[model samples]
Target: MVSVAYDGDEKTIVRRRFLISGIVQGVGFRPFVFRLACELGLSGWVRNIPAGVEMEVQGTAGALDAFQHAQAHDLPPLAVVTSSVVEDIPSIPERGFTILPSADGEKNIQVAPDSALCGDCLRELFDPADRRYRYPFITCTNCGPRYSIITAIPYDRPRTTMAGFPLCPDCQREYDDPLDRRFHAQPIACPACGPRLRLLDGAAEPVAERDDALTRAVELLRAGQILAVKGIGGYHLAVDACNPEAVRRLRERKKRDEKPFAVMAADLATARRLVVLENMEERLLTGPESPIVIARKAQNCPVSPLVAPANGWLGLMLPYAPIHHLLMRDHFQALVMTSGNVSDEPVAFEDNDALKRLSAIADYFLVHDRPIHIRSDDSVMRVFQGKPLFYRRARGYAPRAVRLPFKMPPLLAVGAELKGAVCLVQGEQAFLSQHIGDLQNSSTCDSFRHTIRHLSGILEITPQIVACDLHPDYLSSVHAAESGLPLTKVQHHHAHLAACMAENGLDGAVIGIIFDGTGLGTDGTIWGGEFLVGGYDGFRRAGNFLPVPLAGGDTAVREPWRMALAWLYRSLGKDAFDLDHPVARHLSDTEKGIFAAMLERGINAPLTSSCGRLFDAAAAVLDVRQAVSYDGQAAIELEALAEGAGVSGTYSFGIADGEPLVIDFTSLFTDLLADHAAGADTAAMAYRFHATVARAAVEACVRIAGQSGLDRVVLSGGVFQNRLLTEMVYTGLLDQGLQIFTHRLVPPNDGGIALGQAAIAGWQRGC
Candidate 1:
């Protein structure tokens, strides 16, 4: 109906219609709107719709302007408005603001990422006078578990894991009150009607229940026992960080040797004692996401060094849940809260499954009745250049739609083999699944498939096209091939390029330096250290590390000595053994003969230009690490070793002639070996090796820019996750008058490959 704009004595009357989208549901957006309109003295009716919150406000022009201003600037703490459409409407004769029942239309609204407990909830949790005093699940509209508990959308109490727990009278009253913080909060609960905790023995027998469970679990932790604590997204293996023996025992059981454990401090003050918490790092620790932030360990830290053995850095986070708060406030200063799994498997989310899988690792199970609808691990990040550089995005930071630069067709990008994650694009928002973990075992592959299904089901999207990596053997790629949908295979390095482009909203071609461990090249070789020129449409490989025999192929990645031997053989031929290198000296005759045959005949060995292998080789030559217990251990230790050294020297490297220019490290190996021969400091040599890579990256970018005339360079791939190398390369590129972009929103590793693949596939024919 057309508005009567010129009604008698009502020229100032105005009706404003608004459709606010994105995370508007399940976050008290409707109540926020109701209160704002009432405060502005405007008559309006607000309600939830499938896509977002829809409302119409009728009042004087001045009051309408005030309402709009508040809506824009004064949003609920957890509400994120991706889009707001406001338009003129016919003046209604309504007398007061009202909240109507939800109206259904489209299922396009975003699911809120799981949020940390808010300040108000924390106050109520500890206050003896409050109804939810010391209640583990105490929550309000502003905080607590969100994406973890959600089953479907338009999110409502009936569509969550809490659906079985009918509200008690007190909670029901709060839920029905329009101005109450609990109004329409899907996970709202009271002590009488919410989930209860339980303590179980290794045999799955209940030892304690309800309030007594946590007390008993705390006692176990105090006695240096490991407990499997069920959290919002999944289970965490918790142990007292002050108990060195307990930390070592937990590490042995979890099979996570040498990897640093993430510790949880009771509060910000306790956190400051364990690590050097800068303002930004503190914000991340206590922010809405509450991710584990990697920072330098403070000198004279009280926590056991076994928590991060031989590492200068520590990953710390604050208690994000009332349960954690209570446990932390139980006199203990800190606890190691590591994912509940055997290092390579997905985190245990189901109670029976957690009990079965973690029985050997955990002394007891601290579980709850409320189920986690999806399995999400704790998000991991570090601050670099004043923005979050995600190491792993999950739990409190995931499943939120990443805004795309332009509208794209619905599609699925089933990501790479390691650091597996999936992305689903609908319209202009790409919903990336939580880090599904390395798709190494059957359980991880199952988790990957389930993640795709769960994400697609909740978002109400059926992909028209499926994108997978070019490697045919990957489970993700195999799954894509078996599915009855059209497929697009994206090259690994190119996907990294597109991911950087998509996250930064860049449209045209830019230079991308994607340095990782392994990706199947277009010509059937393994490509990792790559310099490409491209956008989402496609990329052209401009340069890469010089091809060398990857002795034993995948096996070389685990044994750094093998890569060192191969690089030495490539650079100095058979005479490399005369350099007194420990790698060659340590090898037995039979072992050297086997590796020599493999490299010369290419038996089980393949040509690779992986940057990760390069780091492994360097680490081996420097005697930093000869073998890795985990995926990136050698590289991680090398970075730590370099950082510990105060060296800032750069070794020499050169560019070679080829169709795609080669990043030749012949000179680097010679100089690095010279340092090894002279008995120079190992740490200093490691630092110089890293600096040489940064210099080589800059030189490659400079030459590539001259050929392509592209002024922007994006540094991506798993190698770029190294803070020392990233800062160096970023600064080096900037010095050459070239614009540099690095990952902030998404990871620079394979965890973010799905996003890049989805973006590139979105531009394909009829995608």
Candidate 2:
């Protein structure tokens, strides 16, 4: 029997009302609703409420059905729709859907965070005939500053920083027209009525205006003069890359050393000449965020060697703001754009702060009058495994919450040390903050707390539980504890695996290999090398690096000799290893004696299975590093030496019980000692060590995969950030015809830890 069901007639459609809560205020949710309503030919009104967006629709049953589907799936990129309740309303004789004035007194509004101007706005800004042409603040519904402009909820012009500047009649017309992209774009303004740009000399005297000011800024850069150029979220000291003196001067004045400075090139062509660009990389460089940094180096790229000379790759991002675009258009192709601050300090945002604090760094000033509410840094990205991984998520890619597959109660997660980011979750939406730097220092910790509060306000969530790294030494963890929210401690390696799983949308158990510098192990040891079989809810420890004594604790991080002494004791015992090489002279006799005693007695010593420490020991064995000047110096120099020596044959790493017995390296050390005795190149030894380590990892994975039914492997942790190791793993995994997963959207490093924390928290809550 065929059954036919009818609701009134095909033309008479039922109208339903919906109120969506969480991240639905300033992030273009209303604009998205307008588009969907128009597409579905629905009638009634849609408008913002203090708590969220409220909308009513009337249409054919199928049309309403389609609209509902699109409402959930076709949301704007920045919108994080947490909850929506649809109630059937009596059919209304409404002709067409229209945006209504926001209802006052409601309290669930989700203030959208500011986004960089979209491509559509850029097109209009360059259209010579447009009124907003050459405007520094050109914006549309699709993009332009949102969270930065907002002062209160309900996200209207009256409740924003833009409220001070009333829209002119022409702007009003464009803003009122629903058909236009600029319709209801609160920050919209023409050059005649918007913020103005000005150039000033060293003494703070005005030198030029508008386009001329921008042109002068470029000219100053070409002349090897340091100019403090105002950007979207803060000010940056800009200098010509070709000028070694300018770079040196800027670095000295900013009190920066060794650490690499980021560069901003004019466009794709200029960026291409400086670095190799892949298709996805090219698209990322020119896309809305324009954050993508290609890691390949240029052949004598004209930039001073002092600018990231120790590293092969240069950090490059394109001009995203109008002032930047104008400044880059003039003859110069690239500018050295580092943060305007002393090393380890926050980037300056205020006008007075820039002029006062950056006096020594900047030779000139390019000032503007658009009040910046929140300070943000330029987002940094890199291409790995043909995918873009974000190192720093700011500017072009922020406030855009990542939606979870399952819903959960509100939770906040304070991420790990180094490349820190905080996360706030409401229902299924997880909003991760922009890069919050190392929290070991007071300044960075302050930024971490401030950013968390600001992001929490935007998402309109009061976290029920706070998640943090199990490591108590991390300042972020302490801060999370003081917040008074229920604290949930997460294991570091588990969080790393969980982050990869969440990004890949995997919920089942899988084998995970996490390798990094160090983390507090569950058994009260240090872990940075681990293999586990797990899901977000829990994990079973399958294997790990064998722990060895660490001498001088923190001192081991700075001196490879300390780690080398410990490894030698483990590999060859107290009397079997030699320590009379010229490299041995680098350490003080007193220090060497202390290290040997510490290893033998285990005084103030801890054991760790960190693969990173293992690399440090090998690097030290080959005399790659003795006294380190920076973090990861030994490993970095080792990789550089290996790069020159090229790939070699596989080495063996035996399995004991279920775990891999890391070939103690005593034999390898003996061979290296013999080679040194025969006057062999130390570089080849370094290369051989790296090749051996990679082969060991591959072999271990092969055995594990065969024993377990799971064939998929997830490579995670900061250690995988090494290019040589990553390539070796990728090549070996593919050769085995196995599916592999690595990080793409978020970093594989600790920077991506917050997302993992959120995922685990959700699973814990039975989401």
Candidate 3:
């Protein structure tokens, strides 16, 4: 450490100190820096500091300049350098580059998300001569699990789940060598000293070991038997997608009837045979994230229809885990890799938990010894307007910080009841949890609590403020109320608007069009279709849809026929049932009379202006689906029916100009009824109805923008999850010469609402 070097004249000596932030630690950044310094003939020492990575170098001016230039362009694949601060220092006598131990300080460094297997690692994994050949736990610094196994920081092996396994002598040699790829790779292990896999039957007794275990799992999959395979983040219930009987059996056992299942393909070539992929979709499928990309199904695809019954698009993902790669490469072309959870429950992650909970569904279990500290489901995405739109952000994307426009105090935001996710904000970064499923069930609720605790503990954040939705009955709201922190209750629609605003880095006022199934309104009714003018701190309701009775309340959500009756009665009076419509034929006289009495008397009826209910009513009226198996099923089917139809006509609506503008759909319903009476095609009417809604949204935005003098419009809420409707509204607003913002990094659904709640809480507290 005392060697000093001066290449030429003493006058040419120079020294610089640099501080790098953002995912610069735990990703072989120090080794990368050491190699660069050695090659440039510069002497430097790099070490991990709480703020990030710090380095000090002394060399000739030319060598220093080259090093600085390369710092920006060349970096380890996982090192995301967000900011770099450089300062000139007096030349110090240093001879060779060195990697020093990490120093303790205030923790501000970003944790890297899990990465896909890299090309070099894959080559070594498949090479027969390599020591780690066929090793499922083989990993290196450039590619491997990171966020899922981390317990505490400094990003060292002692602080990770791998601490229990001591490295073999040869592996330790590679880990200590600066030139080796495994140097400082916390999860590095060989087959001799790493986690092992085993195949177990329903009784949880071992049936096979190592290579034979994988072979047995493949044979079971090929024989149309479901196997719960433990993966990097969680467990996946795997079945052959081409096996109709197996898919149907799994669906029955899992109680998932119509929801589309995500499939894992062996490789890119295999994925192409099942779904169409564009350039952007291809990149997302094969990229480090390796999220499931929603794509249109290929013509004459070999997969069974039961895998994604009545769905036009299929969720496809290329293998990201080594075990997944090994399973698919030899046995099958595609496998149904759905989450290992019953309906409305969080995905199972623990080995014992998987055995106990999934034994009813899985014929066997292919599990490992490595522990997953926090469970993360596979992320789902779709390509829209030539860019990626996240539906569920998890797996290779969770726990990564989203930089805020301004600093924030420590805060926790419990997200919506449906599609639940929590947020922890510290300083300028907001760390959102992975998808936590709906919080209605006790198992999911417990998982949500565990996720909050685990994420907060690892990120070292203790919130002074707790935020939740205005709905008091929501599970998230209940959790926040009991948190014992200062609380802020954000309006549901406002949170949706604020989420889009925060993600886009907009601080000023914008016209927000929030449409969804339901949210507790300020007036004690239900709000779904709303127009608000607001910023992060607050918002004012500017417009909304006209109220209609939701007959039977929650029961109407399951049976769209109920919504159809409510809408028809409100639009066409007591004689609505006398009209010759398909909905009339489905409802009995006695049932209609009872439903009519409930709506008239307001017994068990809640007034709502929900656009989602409107879509459901239309689907029921058209006899497309009288009952739904899941949330948004009716609307999803309606959108699919309208996909390929060529229709330009749209219904008309009346807007009542007032303090809170009212959008009346009576005329639109009247037009739709006339078309139905004239025997208009259901597909054409569905397309026209979607177009009407899109046009109405643009008109409402224009009216709000004109009155409030806010020309920027932000589209959010679950209704915007409809691709056709979102695109139409986007193009319509842009054609009107308005600045429009939609979700990109965060989802448009409730999964992203926690970020908004945290932002609003921080802004309200003046943090």
Candidate 4:
């Protein structure tokens, strides 16, 4: 039943059929269209099609124009309209607007990412008179879980994790009411008919139930006990961040030594007390994709220093889930919330897995009945030059498609071995998986396979071609070779350059400065410091660092002193080791003798030109860090040490003219040693070193551009993760009047290489 108003003057009716795409399904787009049509007194119907939302409305021209305007401007908060088409059609006799059943067609719709609790939902959640008061899973149409719970297209409850929970009579009434906010909210739930919580001990025996469970969990946290709490995506091991003993105990049990842990603050005010936040950071903290923002820690911060140990910045995130908010508001100011896995394994998402894997670490478990169909980790970000930079993209910001420059054929791209994430490209969209941890671990490798299978199943993509790295020994490359499909092997640095080019929609050749830790070069040596001229089709190596032996191979990565010794040995003779450097003095005589013998014999020693290794060597020379606990640890510490030191001096490097230019840093190393002996401040030296590198990179790019007649520069590789280095290089290049392109949509690290592989495969196929 419906009502319509007619003006006294009979106006001619016109019909317009509209099709909308991009994040229009499962985000209340249909209900929004229905309400707008009814408000305008228009007739006809709207329905969900595989392409997007389709609507045919009949009304006066003036009313139709207003409806069209509202459709673009007054869209639902979560809806992202990438395209819209309006077609004129003959007017049809219709009395009222209706929502028809979904029709089958081509699937081109975008899936909405998970969102934080909205203000309206929060008000009802805390209100004493509301049916969902204090409910752990309170959600409405405006906000709730979306990507993690969804398993298929045309998102409905039956296709989501919520299918197991049937609505009660009250909830069903509200769901059927078009005017209600929960009209088609698939995850809508109330206390009467929703998930429940339980507190279990180490033996898996329930100690508390329902409301009492939360209260007991809070008590345990206050008493300095680690509790594994189940969340929307996976489990998090939480402890009061203010308690140093608790933080230390959790770190020791989890076997994570020096890596910084992300903390969840109760609100913005609480977070500000611990870290400095600007307007942009505050907005990102409270926005729908509430991600962990790396911010400089306040002096004498209230939280225990052990939370982030020697790091100058802390990774802080505001509570994104209702349960997290309730716990922080009712119990603690801030909590150390780290992944539930022991070390290198994937985050535990299932109850049985959490209990089994986390038994050795967590003292108790705050369990929930809701099931997680897919596991997603918390996204990590940092603000640099007033822009959001992603360190890890997951939970609240993944599964949403990145539109390609052109349509691509069906393909699969298995990413690099480190910081693994796979990609599936079909048509004009590329779907990248959430960050799967390093593939060195068997469990992480399993997670990689699971992600590929699940993503393929949901997207219904059957790959005709598979792409992978050129490294023969990489797990991803091996997997791609055995896939029983046509394969393409892409060079490591070429893929990095192509990824940036593809994301920016560039088709022609550009100068690429790709600096990273390690990649298998086509010539069979390790490549990290490289400059190239290329596009999606191919590339030619333009410049590279001077080759030096990595004394103990991977051992040089963990112990920066070994890299420092190698660099010093290469630049100067054995007499160089007699210098009064801290690293030289710290190494044992036996260790030094063995390293020298290995380098001389070229036994277990590989040639490398890695900028990352150079950073580690510099940090070790300056006595900043000798041993690392995680990847990029030495470089990260060096960057922190040089945060605000202003230095105008820069070292010089020689570029020998050849087919592939050789960049020699002998003068730079000589000047560094002289400065160290001259009693220069470590921070100032670190800053000068960074400036030298930036200057060298710009000099090389400028020369390459002059020789190759290419003005566009693409900066890729993991070394660009350093904000100071990236900004300096960008500003220097812009000063030379060069068009520079860097990563924005995808990561600059190995996590984004898969997209490049897929794009290259597509272009090679003549798509």
Question: Which whole-number lDDT from 0 to 100 does residue 280 have in model 2?
Answer: 79
lDDT of 4: 0.87
TM-score head-to-head 1 vs 2, winner:
1
Give the Cα-based TM-score of candidate 3 against the true structure.
0.97
Q: Model 3: which ten-residue window has the lowest total lDDT?
A: 1-10
lDDT of 4 by residue, 133-187 (tens): 8888998888889888888756899989899899999989888877787888999
lDDT of 1 by residue, 1-767 (tens): 12234444433888888888888888888888888888878898998888888888899877777777777788888888888888897886789999998898876768888899999999988899998998999988999898888887667788899999999999999999999999878788877998999999988899998889988988999999999999999999999999999999998999988889999988998999989988889889989899999999999999999998878889998999888998889578999999999888999999989989999999999999999989999899999998889999998878888898878888999999999999999999999999998887999998998888888888888898999999999999999999889999999999999998889888889999999999999999999999999888888889999988888878898899988888888888877755678898778878777777788788988899999999999999888889988887888989989987896779888898665889988778888888888888888998999999999989988999988899999989999889899999999899999998888888999999999999899976533
Cα lDDT tens digits, model 3, 1-767, are: 11234465644978889988888888888999999999988887999999898999888877777787777778887888867888878987778989898888778857888888887888888899999898888889988899888888667888888998899999999999989889989999988898999999978999998889998899899999999999988899999999999999999999999999999988999899999889999999999889999999999988889988877889999988888888998679899999998888889988888899999999999999989887889999999899888889998888888877889999999998999999999988999898999988998999899899888887788999999999999999999999899999999999999999888888978899999998898899989999999888799999998989988998988999888888888889777778888778887899778877898899999999998998999899888889999999999989999887887889888889997899988878778888888989889999998999999888888887888888899989989989999999999999888999888888888999999998899998997
lDDT string for model 2 (240-345, tens) is 8778888988878877766678888877888888887788788887766667374676786776777775567788888877777777765677788888777667
- CA lDDT scores, all candidates in order: 0.89, 0.76, 0.89, 0.87
Q: Residue 581 CA error for candidate 2 (Å)?
A: 4.7
Using all chains and alpha carbons, the TM-scores for the candidates as numbered come to 0.97, 0.87, 0.97, 0.97
Sequence-dependent TM-score of model 4? 0.97
Give me the runs in candidate 2 sitting further than 4 Å from their true place: 1-45, 48-92, 103-116, 123-130, 200-212, 572-582, 588-591, 623-630, 658-687, 704-709, 734-739, 765-767
User: Model 3 clash pairs?
Assistant: none
After superposition, the stretches of candidate 1 with alpha carbons farther than 4 Å from their true spots are: 1-11
